[model samples]
Target: MLHVTTYYDTLKVTRDAPAIVIQAACRALMQLNHPDNFEGREYEAVKIAEDLREAFDVLIDPNTRAQYDNWLAKQMEQSN
Candidate 1:
């Protein structure tokens, strides 16, 4: 499984950021990286857009977010 930190970074947010912040970050990332944002790099743009959607999906769901948060805390504990 991908680390929660990895997911948070995918959405460009801090681990402790609130759900609303996560949602806002996801929206910002989508708007910035959306396929339409890259007029020339269509292929790369599509890939970015897909990644954005996946990140948003995982972070936006409460259950998944809780799981991610738990995993993240565990990782941090292990790291220290």
Candidate 2:
């Protein structure tokens, strides 16, 4: 599963970042990781692109983002 922590890092945004920030991050990352940009590195690029898409998929949806934020909080709590 794609972790919320990964998404935050990929987007270079804090956990409390707004929806617009998430969307902008996804757009920027997708531009760099898009299949067409990979060329010979299709396999690796595809995987990265998929991860970016999954992150956007969750973060773009308010409910899913909320759930992920909660999950991330719990994960941090346990780690601490």
Return the TM-score for each candidate structure: 0.71, 0.81
Q: Which ten contiguous residues of candidate 1 have the minimum total lDDT?
A: 1-10
- Candidate 2 residue 17 C-alpha distance from true site, Å: 1.6
Best by lDDT: 2
> What lDDT score goes with residue 80 in model 1?
73
What value does the lDDT take at residue 76 in candidate 1?
A: 78
Stretches of candidate 2 exceeding 4 Å from the true structure: 1-5
Task: Give per-residue CA lDDT, model 1, range 1-80, as digits (tens).
Answer: 44443787888887678879988988888788777778888899788778877877878888998887798778878877
* Candidate 2 per-residue C-alpha lDDT over 1-80 given as tens digits, one digit per residue, 9 for 90 to 100: 34444677866777788989888888888788787987898898888878888888888899998898898778878877
CA shift at 11, candidate 2, in angstroms? 2.4
